[model samples]
Target: MTHGRSSNILFIMCDQLRHDYLGCYGHPALKTPHIDSLAERGMRFDRAYVQSPVCGPSRMSTYTGRYPRSHGTTWNSFPLRVGEMGMGDHLRPLGVRTALCGKTHMVADRKGMERLGIAPSSPEGRLMAECGFELWDRLDGLHQRASGKQPTHYQARMQARGYRTDNPWEDYANAPLGDHGEALSPWHLSQAHRPARAAERDTETAYSTDRAIEFMEDAGDRPWCLHLSYIKPHWPYVAPAPYHRMYGARDVIPVVRSDMELRDPHPILREFHRNRVSQVFSRPEVRDRVIPVYMGLIKQIDDNIGRLLDYLRKSGQAQRTMIVFTSDHGDYLGDHWLGEKDMFHDCAVRVPLIVMDPSPAADATRGTVSDALVECIDLLPTFIEYYGGTVPTQIIEGKSLIGLLHRSRAKLREVAISEYDYSVRKARVGLEMPVADCRMQMVFDGRFKLVNVVGFRPMLFDLAEDPDELRDLGADPACREVIVRLTRALLDWALRHHCRVTVSDADLQDAIGGEARAGIYLGCWDQGDIDQIIRSGDSGY
Candidate 1:
């Protein structure tokens, strides 16, 4: 395939959206018709997983096509190193104008830039600063912390719309207005059931949708990729007036957890369950108060998706533009006696992935679902393949799913990997562990999932038999073989993905006979060998 000159990509990402909540994914109550249509017109991956369960590291892994271990930004606030390349760094050179609409959770490597003496005002510095994205409207994470002391685009828009509160985001946008016009803070779970103080159109979700459309209009006729990211369904659990009344406790799915999971919990998870978020979610009423609003936020996201799709259809960009919809990670929402997405349970690591390739080549597999194991890093290479760029295997560890999107999957991956660094999490503090020892690795083959901690025994779950993951077989002598096999697989995976980005497959292959051809033949003793080396152009011998 050559460069897709007429092709555009709408990469839609939502924060903290789960796979099971969408209509197409078999949700019983929530109706996400717009998001479901992506599956009907494209491919839905049932077993997609993120590299990390947090925002920054997972998004970095998606952007860079490398593991969190490989990229080195292992937590939420950690900065991506200066040398790491992002999706824009790869796609921009190929004429795909990559632009951001909402949050990337990107923290720039200012120290590395200073050491290299690169000015932040320079083009290269700016690219590194924004994780290689050409910004359109960067409403990153919150109204206040978009950057240190810099007022955000969302804040200005809110204030311009007559919301003159001290903190418009927390007060007007996220807060609920009482009957007497008093502010009911979203921080309290009791007030989360009421509608937000702001109007539906002025909420961040609506603003993000409008700004994405604006970005597309500005990039008319150009081969561009608009990363239409939304910072909703993530936190504060607040929805605008119209959506606030959409659901209640009756609409929320029954929580999938068991008391048995709490009895013999792993040492690491024991501390995690004792944390505030987990303890708060562990209650039934708390879930009833919060989950309905979460459902509303997801419904709000689905509606915006419909608006974006409608625009694409009307503007005639629907036929040529590829659409990839996914989330940074899954929200636990009290699934396994946990919350806030820090564990390797399916609720935190398993994410939704749907891709629609608007080419005739994808006709055969359209509307089909695949159980093939996938990682979020696969998106970067998929974009590269769609744009006809060679995927540098040395730099990108993920395999492209273009083949799967267009045709039958040739083979299944041996295992899917995910990791979490609890160094910044309260779990580490409660346990009083060193930063270096505050991490855990997960290796999940098609059936069994194994998590290896620094000093504790491995935690294993047989997903095939125990889909709810209510039981742990790590301590059972009967499951010793499964543990040993997965441990070996993990060891092999870790050793192979070492820092070898500077070395390519061709470079390593050439080196096999390169030294002998260079005529410094260490083992050559015969005159015929020396004569052959001399007779060769370079290595004809």
Candidate 2:
């Protein structure tokens, strides 16, 4: 079970990639040879969720070993605060050569830096340095409000590098506009859009992979941690050719087939479905064509992953290296008529988590599926525990998967949590454009899910009964007890994480009814007595 001095760690993460899209996860149409190969050589987790469903929050949670609340980052623009610890800080002290390539998405702001679990008051450029990464290729931040169809920054960089300009969107069915609802254009094929000619080159992917391979190959006689992040399979899903045409247009499997059902829905879920239907799943023919391209992106990522693994094995470092493959979050891919990961659906929250040990086991869960219910937060503790590092009990909220890896998954937590705090909450509610005070927390116990919106009714879903989550069981009379039980659990969990407003049992009962509970207050409740708390400064404990 021990490795040599040059034992390395290759951490691969894909943006907005889903577990179901891969062949190893029972996707009948899509071909994920590289992903399947990794599973064959490692262990695949079936029920893995993110601490936060959004890109920035999810990634932040992975690096910090804390949920969004504990880490103090619940949205995209917010940064991890200073003095908060992270995996980078942990690894640096161990003398490991640390490097991050592609997109780290760690913002450089007082708020963002803090939420990233770094020092809050550090100088603008100091967070990255203080993150303890020896090498970094951070991309320039793009203004989300920018008006442009193309990824201008990416395109410009690619053009400068003489990247190919051929069928750019060939395998990028998720590309915005241009190819919207287009026919099965043979132009979506590889020879038509070669990688060498990708007009919009992902410097993150090509350069980061190259950098990772170089570092891994050069790290002789020393241990290292290299994070190779891929940006493809995210938005503007363009990938190089041959990859785009790897599967037939009809071969791409839609993880979320269009379903108009919004049983007991919330406004956010409603808006999400509307956009998904219009943007990606408008027609059956278009749906058929888009999937192949999406799969193409996954295949491209898999190809790069293979390249990294091959290099490690060729250099005789495979047995000494620990490989972990996962995504920041899962993409909707036309499920429930949605295409991204902002919502609380399983398709958005559950991602692919595969861990490969250098010491292969005869009875290891290699190529097998496990529903032990893991999440991104566990990553930090897993590595720390694996390497025998000093992990403070307070900072780490994640449980290590090493036990599961060793087949001793006893006393694991029954639930995983994620949060969101977009400044646009009121906009979502049709009240204002940017309600900066909005916050949401979601608690999932693998079977049932509860989402507590600061200003709305919490959403509850029975995943066992409705795996698609098409039915919202939050207000169902049949699930009333379930809702109350989960609500209590969610409130206690929130209070433990310090993200909730407290209210006393007496005040709550006086405000809502005789049955008010002692737990976290999601937002300003509108009950007469609860309203009195808002007015009397006793907003219920």
Candidate 3:
């Protein structure tokens, strides 16, 4: 695979995969044989991050090469504003053939999908087609499992065989109910929860891998950009039988470091932890059961990656293709007594990023590692630069990592930014909710991390010293100057990127008033700690 010439780019992404989960990354427990093998033959990034800690924002950042705020998508359900220029849209004009298989959570309407070449119209289809991809295996209803109608032959078979539901088979529903028994749990009745899909009907790696292989074979001689996205290792914690049973619960170590919790941590953290302690940790046996199930989900995703890698090797395209494996964001997985994401903490923001260079280096940079700070936004430009495609000016905020990829240059950027919005927070609480008024930001430069909490005092940590983030050096007299410098950096980056600005006094007043206006059931925590607060009142009424 020569550089500057036409080459196949295979982009593999997993939902909610964390960096610490792979064996190569030093996770004593996780069994990711395929990913580890890929790491051995590739360059791994020790400090890769996502623009946002959630699905929509992170994926948007990766595809557009722009910050979430810059791209205008800060939360889920808020579609990437139509006409927003993205990597796919920009790639279409070039001669490269673009194709995507599996989970594309980015918004693409019917017209835009057809233009991108997807047989079925999905939110992501139009955007990919518009970008220049002509081949696609469209699966729109894979995520929600097409409701009253069947969308694909696989889905049709799933419906015919039937699924297991908890209640009267009619009201019981076909999908697996990720139990929302904890009063504060996001799965409560008042929460707009739905069984994502039947455990048996879930689309595994086989579904997407086969499609990608078909695309590669059909592509024949022409150079193509294939976006191979996987939806596993996310939600419901459901994996197929053998995968589900692969890991024994006894072998898995449930390690929740009390230190990961920040002192006076974000209000949301407090609330989530309280629920975990009461509803989950209180029942050790039940908590034990959840880990194995979650690990089972991860194993399934790994197996899927194995299948894809095997296909590439068998087809003799292994050496010719530039392979990149990453995740939209990291899952909490009970770290710091938390489950889902939305925090500036490393467990939430830090993600696994592996880039396998196809060209052979002198010493086989294979298994080489770089602790350079990189974000999801950097991906698009890196690809564009590698493919000789022009990067769009107005929308792109990411710097290309091609230098780091080609020559192992580490000092690309001093800091990386991640954003979070209030919509999902409010929805998790209850609604007809007022807009989220609070914001949090992180500024980390390899050695140090500064967390800016709106209205509340900012927190600074010498990560090199305080690895678990248990100590708060913000108020310490000795580190005051360090705090001041980091604060300035955070503000400068925020203002420059337009991601966020220091909260004003007026903003604080607005937040207080907004919390009152939202009409949420207040309890131990106040509006300032909204993230830590959960509406336990069973009034879906």
Candidate 4:
């Protein structure tokens, strides 16, 4: 089937952004007019969850349309195995070109690539190619302390622009001025509140936005998918001069935590709180200082999104392109006494999902909001379906969102799941737990969220009552039925979707004709059946 000219996709992803930080998602002070514009003309999901709460695994799920366990890339820097079909693989056959302009956080499976004899210098061997995307202009945009190591592409560009420090990415882009006129490093937890020394145009967000525009302008008349991934609002928590001063202590929201939450917390939660990330965020003074900078970074991202949207409209691409704005995951920002994302709290797992389909068919549901339980993995299938491509259900586990986009009330899924494997971090932190015990999985069934750790007690929260997730109902005897129901649901989900990469029993039965096989074995039972089988054998059975 031929796809329409409006089948182009602009998949925008921001790092470590929360759902409540956007104006469209009901943020009171944050000005995201550009992102809000997308919501005004499209469908916004009120309850969207990532497949995982970390960058690498979450992005893997997005690209592959499968869970982390299914893809085998469970954490940051983990490689997606070679030969695994991704969005690009599925879309390219349907005449859509898939390209990435910015960060993918995809560590190529070096071993697999080598075993398959794929050259690293070849287009098919680069990180983009391995992940099923063509490399338009790759820039991960992270260059903190790469003194002796090879600098990132963004850092090289900074040097070419006359920012000539040993680590300009850290000094000019991430550091703030001190009282003595020195570069106060952002890595210092106390100095994370300072403004960045780099100019607004020189920031990573600006660079990524510019590159994305270049890709869009150069894409001529073809249905293309460009992943305009931006590495911002993630860490270094610093923004350029005006954006840094955009918010202050007055704008900071109060940290969400209580004494009751700390009391008899789960072992994993207790360990996380003791970690450096949680320890720094738990302090009142630190929260007061850092939250504002984090807010500033998000505002900068919003402004950049505005710039990109304006360009698309001016270029006449806005009417034909399907714009999807979302994040890999979210930051804790002192929520539930955590800083970086690791656990399964709403702050870390739930992200803003805004999809704007520009086709005339989608006009009826424009600006509508859906409360369906959506996951990040659903995007690939959605893109496939939008391009009029057949979704390879045997490989892609996620259901397409076409029904939801059309304003259908029929539910695509009843539960969303997220998993994290913290064994490496646990071992580094000297935690006295088994390697398998460091993992955790979360299952949310629209209302209740159940977090099951490998070797610890489960944690449950009734989102209807405790949206903050401060109260733990896992230990309550009255909520045992709820726990049992969700647990069984999660178990059934895992069992059904586990790594059965090949054809199933039903598929095999259908592939080889059911009655034909039986008739072939019945040698002397029926002369008529035997004759039919003998005749079919000669006709390429």
Candidate 3 lDDT score relative to the true structure: 0.65
Per-residue alpha-carbon lDDT of candidate 4 for residues 313-384, written as tens digits (9 for 90 to 100)? 899888888999999999888888887998999999999999998877778889988898999999999999
Residue clash pairs of candidate 4: none
**Model 4 misses residue 534 by how many Å?**
7.4
Flag regions of model 2 displaced more than 4 Å: 1-5, 110-130, 139-204, 254-264, 274-282, 360-363, 425-437, 497-541
CA lDDT, candidate 1, residue 54: 91
lDDT by candidate, in order shown: 0.87, 0.66, 0.65, 0.83
lDDT of 3 by residue, 1-541 (tens): 1353557789888887777877778777778898888888888899998888888778878887878767677876566655466666666565567777766666544454445555545555544333323437544223444456544544543445563322211222123344562212223322212332334324445566667777888888676778887776665454455555666557567554565454565554555566543335334464465556556667766777787788888988877778888988887656666667867678778888888878654135678898889988888877776677755544577887777766756467888778777555633353233455455677888877877765556767787997866666666789878878878887787677343333343455435434434655445344545543334322122
Give candidate 3 misplaced runs (Cα > 4 Å).
1-6, 108-125, 128-135, 138-145, 148-150, 157-202, 259-268, 274-283, 361-364, 426-436, 497-541
The top-ranked prediction according to lDDT is: 1
Q: Where is the poorest 10-residue window by lDDT in model 2?
A: 167-176
What TM-score goes with each of the models?
0.95, 0.77, 0.77, 0.92
Model 2 agreement with the true structure over 1-541: per-residue lDDT tens digits:
2344456778888888877888888888776787788788788888888887788788888987878877676777676666566677777666666677666667645555556665634443464533445545543223321244444444444446554443232322223223433323333422222232332234345555776777776666778888877776775444455665576655755445434455535766665556633355545565565566667778777777778878877888877788999999877666776655667787888888888866543146666667887888888887776665755545677887777777767436877777877564333655342465466778888788988777667788888887878777666788788778877888787677333223333344456522234433445545665656555555444
Candidate 1 residue pairs that clash: none
Q: Residue 214: error of model 3 in Å?
A: 2.1
Candidate 1 lDDT by residue in tens digits, 239-287: 8878887888888788989898889788898988898888898888988
Model 4, residue 451: C-alpha shift (Å): 0.9
